[model samples]
Target: MSLLQKIQDLEDVLKKEQLTVDDLVAAISSEIACNSYLVSAEGKILSYSLAGSNSDKNADLALKLEFKQRVGFVFQTVANLPLEANFLENDNSFAPNTHMAIVPIHHLTSTAGHLLLTKKAQQFSEEELILAEASSLIAGIYLYEKANENNSDSQHNNIEMVLESLSFSEIKAIHSVFTELNGLEGFLVASKIADRIGISRSVIVNAMRKLESAGIVNSRSLGIKGTYIKIKNSSFLEALKLKVR
Candidate 1:
């Protein structure tokens, strides 16, 4: 079935009755013919669904272990919203050419967790990518409500402080860098950001400097080639997403 049709069917089921996080994981996995995991921002597994025997029969202990080892990597990749399919290659733990769709589950503006979907197949279609993103957003909202119910005032206060640290321009730069993350591009340079936002290179560099001081981005010089920049952590992207929005 098409990805859109599968998503519509899932929505129908979701509307019929509330499903626990685990139930949602299983349903998403089945609909997409892949293994699905809901992991906390700190890389704890909240729920997971193993592909059925008829599907991806190689979903074995080794595969699970591989995912365990790479869960942090997965979260880091999708900490920013709207990321493309990340192709994990040359990892003996998984089958050759495994594709992982990493989606950040946000709470309000901050990322509370991640949804990781994996299949031993080629790249996912654009339709599948859209479905994965929508599923993660749903999961994020559910998790956000759950966290709010359990969190103390001090935690919320701390999060607010972090959100207030960045200026608007810095947030935009971070957002632009995150939106471009894909298999083809990893780290972004200042010039790229300048061109993307129609701002001057100097202005972009100044923003990056502030972001670096805030520990949101890391930069390095390549001599004549100029400097390249990257987000320092996934959590920073989450916070920036919340602040910028």
Candidate 2:
């Protein structure tokens, strides 16, 4: 297939929400007719489809370790190069004919991971190199989107935890003050909240303490500047029934 057509096929694979990096690697392996792996920047093998079989678990572990070391060394060696495919000739006696290509998977300006391909006794064609680069880009996008989703879920969970920790009165106090602020940025005075809501200063202070303790907010006394309040989780606005402004 032409490189453009192969890239279009990879794009179709990416459109599937259920598609994983492993599936993507497998597709790339089939397209290029070689063993493929997706290794994280930290040298963890995220996905792979090796040609040979290891009969023993220990052999598999050793093989994985050796691959990791190889990837790490090559990654460090080419760290200064532009994000592209780099070829290496393997010296391992066990796989004398093995030739490897490493493509750095990039997310924006940062290296997110890598796409590694190994072929026995054959140098990679230009078309194969370009396909690997395209695959790496797709893998980077997939990994980055997954990371964002996980972060958003974690933030939502934290907001729920803080919401569960609050008493009805405390929620009311928080709603009153935050609503009055109307998405204003900067420090807010506890006494100001107390005066506006007709609640005791101690009530406002305690509520802030709970938020701070839950890691949902940050509070610091600015002395005459009242108290510096910074909400770490913006989802708290919707959770507390306040405007998300």
Candidate 3:
């Protein structure tokens, strides 16, 4: 996808009623090629993403443990900062030479949370820092909208209407299919989507058939190659992202 289209996708993901902190992390991480974390002002780790191998897992666990232990201190350090971004070569939770950046997430005029980005490299360029700051602003807007929507009765009803007919697994299947098929032609492989979603192939196939019957997707048999799938109605697929906001 073009950079502009990717940005649009991120914005769309944020607006979805099903938006979560991990979704935010995943979007930013996938865009920037690094681990991303969202932490609330109250020292809670809202979401995080670290994609890789066994060493990555070890590092991820250690980082989470350290964050849990020292999140309060980290919060306090930037609690009074303005709408600017900052970087630290090493923090209480990170080793020396580890790269970390902190960006403020504001809701309207007040701060709501912080975005923490980490990479194995020792430093990030000024351009990257600016991008991080911008990403944090987007995340803040998402959080603000989510908070308001959750408190709005009208939004609640709309969300229920959108999700009432879909089961959790079906929703997941739709989301997986939609994300994978974005900006692509031909067809999406159901088994690959099933693997990525951590669900069985049979489940994914059933979900795809249901979606096809509902006009949310077009599915065709490829004989021994299995089913070839394509999203038919993107708006409907987007609506499937509705959450109990």
Candidate 4:
């Protein structure tokens, strides 16, 4: 809507919804106060309240968004990474206005989405850069909140997929016994791992007949009781811990 029309609509919505414009404006105004610009999670124009906004040159911001989106898919494939993992800096070019960061809305350690600063000039002062990064962080958190509110089905599916991948019956058989592991320290035979996983000795030997089959545990002999060591999967084992937690 045009500015005048938006004002009228805001007035109508506030009256109809029994809310306040300050409540709406305060959220947008906060970004304006910080960086003079704001963007939607998809990098669309949410606002360019400040006159000097370089939103037109937000390609750097756009690339960062794409990178974050690709990595954010990890929410479906991996466990929650610590804040410091994905929250690290991209590039420190030191161009004040052009300085930007990608902040993702993440919950349960998975990024649901992110937002970017709308614009900047050739350079941003340290203060402006700080404000831009802070604003991006705020936008990320807000987007995550909104996605959580809306995408219950997607999250549910992800949770189920995670559980299934982690609990593949054959993989679980090893995890069930990893802590109590028994193996040849000097040169035990491979039969021990088979015994631990509850498969017959011949099954273990014959299992290696095929390669790269899922749900089959692989083993290698090192030495002593640790010789025949069971290897379910490094990545899957790690994923299991993540999903379990």
User: In terms of TM-score, which candidate is strongest?
Assistant: 2
Best by lDDT: 2
Off by over 4 Å in 3: 1-9, 15-17, 51-96, 153-245
Per-residue CA lDDT of model 1 for 1-245, tens digit only, reads: 86668878767545545557777787778776777877787766677776784333232222244544555555434421332333223324346456677777766556677787777746666766777777876677667656665654544554456556646665576567667663212655667767979766776666666666656567787766666566654555555566777
lDDT, candidates in the order shown:
0.63, 0.70, 0.61, 0.40
Across 1-245, the per-residue lDDT of candidate 2 in tens digits comes to: 77789899988888886887667877788777777777787876676765553322222222245556665655321211221233322313235566777788877767777777777767788788877777777888889988998989998887887777777767778887676666634667778888877878888778879888877778789898787777777778877874222
The count of backbone overlaps in candidate 1 is: 0
> Model 4: per-residue lDDT, tens digit, 145-192?
545656655545543454454324434444443434443112345456
- lDDT for model 2 comes to 0.70
Q: At residue 114, give the lDDT of candidate 3.
A: 80
TM-score for candidate 2:
0.78
The count of residue-pair clashes in candidate 2 stands at 0
